[model samples]
Every structure is written in C-alpha cells, then in structure tokens.
Target chain A: MARVLIVEDEMLVAMLIEDVIVDLGHEVVGPAMRLETALEVVEAENVDFAILDINLAGKQSFPVADRLADLGVPFIFASGYGAAGLNERHRQAQVVQKPFAPDQIASLLERL
Target chain B: MILQNDTPNIDPFRFLGKDGEAAEIIRTYDWSSTPLGRVEEWPPCLRTSTALLLQSPVPIVMLWGEEGVMIYNDAYSVFAGSRHPALFGSNVREGWAEIVDFNDNVMKVGLAGGTLAYRDQELTLHRKGFPEQVWMDLDYSPVLDEEGKPAGVIAIVVETTERVLAERRNREEYERLQNLFSQAPTFMAMTSGPEHTFEMVNPEYQTLVGDRQVVGKTLVDAMPEIAKQGYLDLMDDVFKTGKTVRRAAERVMFARTKDAPLVERYVDFVYQPIRDERGAVVSIFTQGSDVTERVRAENHQKLLINELNHRVKNTLTSIQSIVTQTLRGVQTREEASKAITNRILALSRAHNVLTAENWDGAELRAMVVSSLEAFQVESREAIRINGPDLRVGPHAAMSIALALHELATNAAKYGALSFSDGSVDVSWQLLGDKFELDWIERDGPTVVPGDRKGFGSRLLLQVLPLELQGTATIDYRPDGVAFNFATSLEAVNDRPALEGV
Candidate 1:
C-alpha cells in the first residue's frame, strides 16, 4: 500500500481524487488544499506518491511538485486543462483528465 | 382755349384753310428750322398734329414735307437740352448729322409707308444733360402720308439690366448642385414626400442597390428586404420627428447580383428630413457607406486567438512525452540529464523555426536541416537530404525534430556515423495536405541496438499520437534505423502556430 499526497484547491475535485486514491489500496495523506499547505506537508511527511492538480485556488502546485521531485516521490497530474498549462519540465508527468473514471486514475497511479 | 398745367385742345394752325386742314397743316410747317430740313409737305394729319405735339409731356417728333426728320414736344426739348435744338421741323440728315444714320433707318421704313414698331431696342445715348451714356430700349413707329410717303417717326423706350442678372444667378446654383450629386462617393438618393419614393439616385446609390431601375420607386418597392430590415421604418421616424437618424456599424447583407453571393456589410448612414417652406417634411435624404471588410477582419482575429490556446496545450504534451521517455531509458543520472537537455534543445530549435515564421508554419527542409545540424560534424555527403520543398507546422515540426535528433544521436553513437564510413539519408513527400518523411541510416556499424527498451522507442511509439495528431514508426532492422511519420501540413502551416491541432 502506498501513502499518497493529494494537492488540489477545489474541494469537490480534491474529494473525488481522494476517494479514487483510497479505493486504489493507497492511504491518503492530508489532502493539502493550497500550495503553501501542500509544500509544508511534503517537507514534513513521508509520501510514496503524489497526485497534484496544476492549479490550486489561485496558485500553481508546481512548487509542491518540485519539492516531491527533490524527495524522489513519484507523482501524476490530474487536470482539466491541457499540457500547455504546466511548466516545460513537468510536462512529462502522467496526466489524467478531469471527470476521469476511477479505473483511469488507478492506471495513471500504476504507471507512476 | 388751353390751361397751362391742366389739359389743352386747339386747332391753332389753319395753313390750307378749314376745307383741307390736313393739307393746310402739312404745307405750313417750317421743316428747315428743325432737325429735318428742306421739307415741302407733311402727311395731312401729322401736319396738323405737329403744331399741337410741341405742347405735350412725352417726347414726340415729326418729319414734315418730305424732310424725313424729327419734331419735339415740350418735354422732349428738356430731354434733348442744348443738343440738336432745331429738333422740330428739321432735316433729319443735315440738322442732326451725327445721328442721321439712325434717323435714316427709321425714316426708310416710313418712306416705304410701313408702320415700324420696335420694342425694347437698346440704344446708348450721351445727351447734353446726361454726361455718361444711358441705356434705353427704344421703340420707333412710323406715320405715313395719304400718298404713302414718309412723314415722321415716334420712339418709346425702357431698360432691362436687372432682370438679366437674376437669371444668370439661378443657372449657377443649379450647376453647383449637379456637380455635388455626381461626385459624391457615398450612396446618396433623393426621395420625395414622407413615403420617401426615390426621385433620383446618384451613381453610388445605383451601385449599392445593384439595380438601374431604382428611381421612381419607394424603398419598399425597390428593395423590400431593406424595408423588412427597418430602413423604411427609420425613414418614417425621421420624417415624423423632423430629426436625423444616424446609425453606425449597422449590419446588412446586400445581394449584388442574382447569382452572386450575398455580400455582408456593416454601414453607417444618415436619414435627414428635408422640409418645405411651410416647415413640413417633404422628403428624406439618405447617405451611407459600406464597412464589411473591417468587420470581417475583426472576426478573423478572434478565431486566431482561440486556435493559439489549443496549440500551446498540445505543445506541452509533446515536451512531457520527451521528458518522460528520455528519463525512462537512462541508467545513469548524467546520461538522463544529457539526453533530456538535448531533446529540450531539439524542441527549442523547432520553436525557433515557428517563431521566425510567426508560428504560421516552418519549412520541412529547414526543420530537418536544423535538427541534423547538431549531429552533423561533416559536409552534405555525410547526410543525404532528398525531398521536395515543403512546410511543417509548430506541432509537427517539433515532433519531427526530436525524432530526428534521437535517430541522429543513436547513429553517431552506435550506428552509421559512429565510424568514418557512415551516412544518413532523409527524404520527404507531400500527400495532399499531409507530409510523409523517412529517415534512413546507411553504411553504419552493424545496426545492433537490439530491442533495447530505450527513450527512443517510447518516443516514436507514443508521442506522435498525443502531440502531432499523427503516427511515427521506427523499424529496427539488421541494416539501420528506418523511421517514418505522417502528419497534416495544415496542422503545421496555420499561423500563430498555436492555432492548429
């Protein structure tokens, strides 16, 4: 079982992603709802994998993703927006589209 | 008997006795003492009237006794003044020598015994009382003798300078209006009455309506569609309110010809109420300009912006694939970093081509050459590029560049270019709006990178579908790496590179 961090601003989408992760035999860490909070969680906790939304309420989760990368934690991005919304370096990360099926989320997590 | 200032009547002269009053007066007149000279007899009634005419207010003159000259009344003496004082009973030629020719012409008609009536015959006379020449319209009539011989001439005159000047000004005003109507560039038409029935249309108006038979027709009759679009209603409003209606950017579509496409136009127009002397609306004047091109340009710009958004998203996905695959194959950190940086540089070079072309599209040959330049340490013989000139869009160009770079790098490290006797062949062709290119490596080391699940493998298989809306296949043969891909030329050529799929 993997300990996964969820970083998303929208409460509804965050909850949906969290439900999918928990169903996938993964334990959910603090579903950090903001970029600052997500960054702090990444520094403080042990995360096996992270599922990030590119945009928080009004902030980018790029900083958290960068921190995860430094910590050697694998992550996938779930976004409604296209790849252009991400920074150049992070474009290679696995992306699961929004309103995605639970199985698609599991497969993306499996790939990571 | 006669009163001095009242009215007078008298038979004063009895030259031929009462039995022959006309003959007696003609024989007794002293013709030599006036402007007419050496006259023997006058016409019978003129002879008697000549003595009485000297007492009248209007100018009167008599030529008596065949002298063919003039006589004067009391008012005429004052008008004639000191000049030609022998005006009465004087010879026309000898007494008034300077004016004899004019007198002769008048007398000649009388001598033929014809009554000559000349009305408003302009004459300029410089008389004693008038220092400057005065204009006059003289009417001369001749009185004949019983024997049909010339006796005298009568003159009446009037002047006409002011009337002539007024007519000239009226003509000038009409010409000015005609000049304005013909030269105006805007569609202009004059309509009569509140119904705004077209009375006349300028050339521009005729061109706008695309019909020659617009005149004498109401707006509804000529172009019912215009009425349906509320143009006629607007005219009615202008007439009712006595106010002008000015509309800008008014959208309309006009049919130029029966078979032609409807031309969409935006227009600015004015409907001005023309009022009569009673301050009632008599007509409406309409003037308008077509502005279709400007509106179309604005719509095109908006479409371009939306397209750019999609292109940027697709571009990011491509970079992501490159990164993920490159990192996947690397066994060492340094090697992974180097591969990623090189791939990034390849992507950057494609972007530069897009930027230089303002994202419209990049040339296929140019993109190929740019990608191969990094790997090409030698001349053209080392790398054979064979293809017709073509262009590729940002998405396709970037993908193709990275793929080429991967192939070239592999060639340099282990295949053809790894030794001094190796070479590469690249060729492309256009199939409709899609471009197909092949990168074939030859004369290389034995082609032995056998089934290694590397970054290059994943890139060729996965990235093309997500980024280019195309397909890429890499054939691992015993001879060399043969790579092929196909994508839409339109996808690569559309402007602002962000626009296409």
Candidate 2:
C-alpha cells in the first residue's frame, strides 16, 4: 500500500479525500490543513505521493509543493483554480479541479 | 532800381522739391525771422538735404545748425499730429519740449558727425493736445556742408505704438496659457517632432511618470519601459497619421519612485496630434488620468465572485460526504433521510451564524444557541449555556456547531433531554492561553456507550479534535453523558487574512 499525504484546509473535504485515499489501499500520512503544517509534514513524512489543496485557510500551499519537489516526491494539486492558479515554475505539475470524482483520484493513484 | 527788383521774387526755397503741406509751409515761412536768416542765405548743404527729405515717403525732418530749426516732409506732418504747420521752422528742442532731454542727446550726437537710432523707444508727447504714451523708431544722421563739416541733423521718426501694444497682448495671453497648463488637474505632456521629444510636462504628468527629468528627452529614452511596452509605437502612429488615439482603463507598469519595484496601474489616456499651420503633424499632446484604484476595485469584485463560487462548490462536496457517510450508518431509507436532513440542517444553521458575521467569525454563545435550537428542548432553562463573549473563527465555529448538534441530538434521544425533567449544563472558559468547554448531562435514562463506529461518534471523537487542533472526550456515566473539549485560544480563533487569497 502506498502512503499518500493529504494537504487540504476544509475539514469535510479533507475527510472525503482521506476516505478516498484509504479506499485505494493507501496508508494516510497527514491531512495537514495549514501551509505551515503541510510544509512540516513534507519535510518529516516519508510518503510515496501527496495530494495538495491550492489554498490553506487563506494561505497558499506552494511552499509545501516546493519542499516535496526538493525531495523528489510526486504530488497533485487539488484546487478551485485548477491549473490556472499555478506559477510558471509548477505549470507542468498535475492538477485536479475542485468537486472531482473519486474515480479521478483513483485513476491518478493507479498511474503512480 | 525797378529793373534790379524785377527778378520775379526769385523762389528762394525752390530746393524743397515736393508739393506736400510741410513743404508749402516751409516755402511760405519767414525764414528771415529764424536763426538761419532767409532761405537764400541758407548754406548749400542744408538746401540740398531738405530737397532730399521732402521727396521721400518716409517721415524725415532736418534740424539746421546750432538753432536746430525743423524742415520736414508730408509723412513727417502726419506723424506730427496737431503739432504741424507751426512746427515746420521751429527749433527741435522747443517744438518737442516735453522730450527736450532726449532730443538734446540726439542733437549732440548728430551735429558732431555721429549717428543715433532708437527702436520702439517709449515717450510721452502732447501730439493731439493731451500727454499720450507712445513708442517710435527714430534714426538721425548729420548733414555735411561744402567743406565736409557737419552743418545740420537729418531725423527719421516712425511711430510703433500699435505693434508694441499687440506684442504685449500676445505675451500676456501666452503667460495665461502657461499658468493653465501647469495647474491643470489631469496629466498632460507635449512631445514634438518625429522622434517624439518631450517638450513640456505638467505637474500631474511628472507625478504619473515618477517625477523623472523627462523634458528634452525622447519618449523612448525617457521611458524605456514604456517603449518596450509598445506604447511608443502607438505614439509613432499618432505622429504619422495626425490622428487622435485613445485608450480606457489600460494596464501600465511603472515605478512611481526612482529605482522602485515596478507596480501595475491602469490609465485612461489620449494622444492627440498637434498640427502646424500648413496641416503637417508637428507634435503630440498627451492627456491622461491614473485609474489604478478603480481598476483594482473592479478586479477585486471579480475575485470575490470566483471565491464565492469555489466556496459553494466545496460546500456541495461536503454535503456529498455527509450523504455518503450517513447512508453507510443507517439500515432503512427513512432513517438515512432523517439523518441526512438533520446533518445538513445543522451545517446550515452554523452557516447562518457565520453569514451574519460575513463569515469572518462567530460568537461561541451564538454557535451554542443556534446548534441547540434544532433539538427544540421546549424550555430555555433545560439546557443552560454559560460562556464569556468569545469569538471563534469560521472554521472552528462550524466544527463546534456541528459537534454540539450531534451531542444534543444524542442527549435528546437517550441521555438528558429524553425525559422532561432532565437538564444539560454547557459552560466554557479560558485557562491561561488555553480554551476549555464542557457539556454535562444529568437526571435522565442510564447512559450506554454503544457502537464506536458511527458517523456522529467518529465526527465527535475524530473530526472535531482534528478541526479544532485540540482534544475531545465523552464519558458514558450511568446517570447521563458528559463531553469536554480543550485547545489553545489561538487555534480556535484563527481569523483569515484580511486580504483576499
């Protein structure tokens, strides 16, 4: 089973993503809800992949993405802004738009 | 003796050639009564110069010898105004006595074989009966005798009052226009030639462009950034076509201070080509206003709409989770429908409190009251709520509201509020920097810890603690149920950033 780190701000959304990750036979690392916590989790956790929300409360989650990139860990952004919100540096990274189906995450996890 | 006198009164002033009024007056004058004796006794050089002066169309007058006697032409009589006829043979100093000192200087220079000239010289003269301010151009040269010695002074007087006054009026009008240009409220600039060289910039234009020394510099050299942004091309088009170009709420990046970071701004502007008299494009006049505030306000409104859309979509996802989790816990469709309705209603009530506060935060007491209102205890005293007026952030408020709903629902079904005499006391307080709250039930049916894996139990035991960044516990006491939650005040009151994400 792959260990997937979930970084989302909204409680229900995080819980929903947590349930989806668990159903895919993956071990959960943390659903870090704040940018600072996500950054810490990226540095501390040894995970196969990560799912990131573009916004944490009112802060952005790009710092966590940067940390994860430095560690060579794969990740996907889950945001209302979708791919449009990313800076040029991370434009090529994976993205899932908000209100995504469980099968979307399932298919992406299967590829990883 | 009669034959000697019959020389036919030989015209002594025959050298005065023209038949003008001034010439006639000189011819009939009693020259024998003046310092120059008679016209026949006059020196040959004075007679010759008078002939030359009278024939010319220009206003010319000859002042003779030391007495400086006047001899003039038709043009000079017109310039003399009411001082003519009698002034024909008068002394230069006595005839223009109001300006005797000025004439004295001219006579001194001219009779000494020197020349004098004045251009638009200001003077006061009694030309038409009253002293009048006038301007004139004057030239004086000495007349020589047969021996090449100075005998008289020849003077040319040209009145220039009209020209001088017109020039003064033009100067005043120019000064007024300059004042208006400097004090104008909008940004304005004038650029000349094909190169678009900056000729003038007003205060507002200077402020708009970071107060740089832009005058005398080409538009490209003064603002390289603007040139790179393709605005110079637009100006070039204006200069070439002699047309006006206008733009509204266009984005421009500029550093308002020297060497400062580039800041984006919006502007409404026009470039109008100024033409020469021959209809050739000579320059461009630029006028504009900085509309950054208005543009930013419009952009902020769009962002808020998008954020609201995102929030609504996420809330729908949350409701989906509620439905999916609720179905997994119930046996019958009726039970599942009631559970989903109550859960969604609980979330909606929390939203009502938050929406009233514009979602910035909510009062803890308001959250508690709203959450318990769904259970309908019938009497206010059955559920006692005590807390300081503490405001929690929107996220914490939502979690606590839902959690309270679950706990109260459980109490009404089996624990405290199941019987009419049962009571529940909910109280909270701050301990140092920590936040603490309790929900204690009493005087109801015996409490039983049922399944450990229901939606309500999982949310209370797991989601509430995670959302609050705190801890929560429920003790299934035989008398009733007691629930307590604790966290740092900072965690519960995490206000969103004031600026939009």
Candidate 3:
C-alpha cells in the first residue's frame, strides 16, 4: 500500500478522497487543507503521492504542488473548474473533474 | 427711250422711261430706306425683280413687284424649279404654293402699311429646284406709292438654324451642372478673384455657414478672422499660378450659431482657378465635410477599453487573496471543509460586485461594508468603521474583503469580538492612487496570535502581495492586533458592491 497525502480545503471532499485512497489499499497521511500546513506536512512526512485541489478555501495550492515536485512526489489535481482553468505550465499534470466517480479516481491513481 | 427693235414686243424698259430717267430716279431714291441697311449693306441686286439672290453663307431673298419672291443674284434658281418661266409675272403665293400661308401673312402685314418682322420662323419651301427645311428670321416692309398707299413689299430674310441649335445645347449643359451641384452632399462654394469673395454657394455650404451671409461678399468682410488665418492666401496662390491647390483632412473649428457650442470638423477642399476666355484666373472653388462626432466616438471607446483592462487585473488579484486567506483559516479537518465553502461563497459575493458594474469596477466603502456584514450581525458594538466615500477596483475589493474576514473570524473566536467588552475599529484614508486601511482591536480578550502560524497571519503578510500586488502589515500589540493595508485605488473601485446579497 502506498502512503497518500490529501491537500484540500473542503472537509467533505478530503474525507471522500481519504475513503477513495483507503479503498485503493493505500495508507492516508495528514489532509493538510491550507498552503502553510500542507507545506509542513510535505516536508515532515514521507508522502508517496498526493491529491491537490487547485484552490483550498480562497488560496491556491500551487506552493504545495511546487514543494511536492521538489520532493519528487507524484500528484494529481482535482478542481471544480476543469483542466482549462489550470495554467499552461501545470496543464500536463493529471487532473480529475469534481463530482468524479470512485473508480475514475482509482483509475487516475493507478496511472500515476 | 424704248430702244427695243420697232417690234410688237412689250418692252419692260417703258416702266423705267429712259436711261437718264431711271438713273435720275435711282439717284433721288433713299439708299438707307430699309431697316436691314442699318445692320447690313444692301446687295447689288436689291432693285431687281427677275431673280436676284445673295448667298455667300446666309441665303437672303428679296422680292419686288411681279418677281414672284425673286431671290438675289447669288440665290440658286433651283429654289424656283419648273415655275421659273411663270414666276416673273406671278405673285409669291401662286409661285410657291407650299409657302402660301407664310406669304399671305407677310403680304397682309405689308398691305396694312406696317413692317412685319419674325425673329425665328420654320419654313419648308420648294425654292429654285430643291426642298429644304430652313429656319429664318424675316422682316417684310412695304414700299409706299406717291399717295402713301402700299404698292410693293420688300423681304429681308436670314437663315438661323445653326445659331439656334448651338444655344439650345448650351442651355441643356448649364441645367445639368446646376442639378449636380444642388444634389451634392458636401459643402461647396465658389469664391471670385484673389480677394476670395463668395460668388456662389450650394445648399450644404449655406447650412454649414449657419446663419452667416455668404453670398456676394469677400471672405474678410464676412469673417475677418478666417480671412486673416491664411485662408485667402491659399486662394490667391491658386489664382496667381492657375494651378489647383488641394487641402485634405484639414481640421477646423466653427460655431454653428452665436450661442452654439464650437464643433470640430475635418475638411477636404480644392481651390481651382476659374479662368476667362483669355486664360486669366478669376475664381476658386472649395468643397469639404464635417467629421467631429465620429472622431470623438473613436477616442471615447479607446478610453473605455483601457478602464476595462485595469478593472479585470484588479479582480484577479482579489480572488487570489480570498483563496489564500480561507485556506489559512482551516485548522482541523472539519474547519478546513467549512473554510473552503465560506471562501467560495465570499468569492461569489465579490463576483456579484463585478456583475453589478458589468465587470467595470466596484465601490470602496460598499465592498468593506458588505464584507463585514456577516461579522457585524453577530456582534454589533464590537465593530466601528470610519472612512469617506471611496471607490475600489475589483482586485482591491476582493483582497480587502478576504483580509477583513480573517480579522473578524479571529476576533470572534479569541480576540475583541469574542467578549462583550471587546471592540474593533476599521478606518481608511486615501493617498493618491492608493488607499491606506487600518484595522485596530481594543478592549478585547488578552490579545495574541497563537504561536503557531494561522491563516489570518499568512493572509495579512504573504497572500496580499501575491493577490493584490499590495502590502499588509500586522502589529501584535498587547491591547489587540492592529493590521494596516496599502493598495491601489483601481482595485477598490473596479468591483462595485453586490446588491441584495
């Protein structure tokens, strides 16, 4: 089982993500919702993969994404606005539209 | 004096008596008797009745008693044809049956002892041997006898077909030019001589002048200032050189009426010399149009686009701040979930501000008032706001709104708004294109930002710059937390306040 990190502002979404990861036979790490807290988690914990929300509350999670990249951790993005909303430089990163099925999430994680 | 042979032939020479008698009669007779002699000398065959016609270019016919419309010596006998033998003794009517009515009219007028003159008359006559349609201006005068009674009629006729046709063609061309001038859309005028005196003006030209008399007057006499400004000089140059001078897209300002606003116009004109037959320049023609409204509209549209760009940039910055601050507030799993929802709702509210102005910009005080409404309802006395009427762009509004939310959340949880004794003061001042806003807390529960970094601190320090392109400072005073923000005025005014939200 892989250790996965959930960086999302919404408690329900984070929980749903946690459930999806657990169902996938993966261990869940801290679901750091804010940028500062998420960065802290990335630095302290050994995260195998991460699921990041483009916007956490009012703040973007780009800093967390940047830190994850530096740590050589693979991650995917989940946004209500879809892939077009992401900047061009980060567009290559995998993204899942919101209101996604569990299997879709599982499939994306498997690819990653 | 009948020098003819002693034969039975009736000698016409008896009518003249003898050579000396005929010579004496001719000498005493008035050579200047006919009115035609005033403009033209009589031809040598004027007194003949046999068939005398003068026809160098213009055919002239003179008929005397018993000559049957005798033509001058130069007149062709073909005009008489088969009737030539009988024409010597016959009257004009019997000799030329086709011209009987015309002959009768002239004969009647001559018989009444009056001169008959027809300026232009069309006549088809079988003269000599050929039939031809001839236009003639004829004058018939009677020669009186000794008792002052009519005896014989003398005809003076000039063919005028060529002159009449030429005059008709000239009139038609002049009418066509007038029609074109009247229908022209641009203002057109003609000025005479180097003095540039207005000679003629079209309807559009009259309308453009608007209450100014522009005919038969020099430009200086009509508008002294316009003449002084080298307008006359241009006309003078065209006249002197006999060359056309064209002025294209020249800007000019004029008042429509005495009390009307000055209107700007663009004029395109040509001053060409109107030369006489001698090829000397005499006048100049000018034409032009007015284009003020179109030019003004183009400039106004450009300004509106620039204003739109400024507002959009500010809005993006505000959204950035809201997202950053909301995420900072999320602590536990439950709070993190709630914070995201609240932040999105706040962002939607800001979007409403954008929509109100159709995304142009927003009001300053309104943005602050709306953002604090949620926090204000829970605690009335805890908040105090002070600022004059102001406007902010969308970016500034969003940043300020998110920043205020953070302060209020913290105050409600552990700072000033947490207790009845605590209070918060929000005040702002304008400084050029930027506004300085201060949020100070007083009489609150023992003040401290928890040692661990919180969402409020991160928003006040780091997120403001990333989002608003602005700066925010927070002072951890023992009394409370004091926060100051400096941002662009465009950001504050670009996002108008949301209504009914």
Instruction: Give interface RMSD for all predictions.
Output: 14.0, 1.9, 13.1
Provide per-model DockQ scores: 0.03, 0.35, 0.02
Which rank order by lDDT, best down to worst?
2, 1, 3
The better candidate by DockQ, 1 or 3, is 1
RMSD of 3: 16.4
lDDT of 2 by residue, A1-112 (tens): 8999998877778777888898889998878887877888887878899999887777778888888898999999988777877877789999998888899999999997
User: What's the distance in Å from true for residue B335, model 1?
Assistant: 6.6
Which ranges in model 3 have alpha carbons more than 4 Å from their true place?
A1-112, B1-58, B63-103, B120-135, B144-149, B259-261, B277-279, B305-501
**Candidate 2: pairs in clash:** none
TM-score of each prediction: 0.57, 0.76, 0.49
Question: Residues B49-147, candidate 2, lDDT per residue (tens digit)?
Answer: 888988889999999888799988899889998998778789989999999999898888887999998999999999899999999999999999999
Mark the 10 consecutive residues where model 3 chain B has the least summed lDDT: B49-58
Report residue A29 deviation for candidate 3 (angstroms): 48
lDDT of 2: 0.86
lDDT of 1 by residue, A1-112 (tens): 8898887644324445565686788998867755777888898999999888776543578998888888889988876564656787798877775546678878767776
Task: Please give, as one word, the docking class of candidate 3.
Answer: incorrect
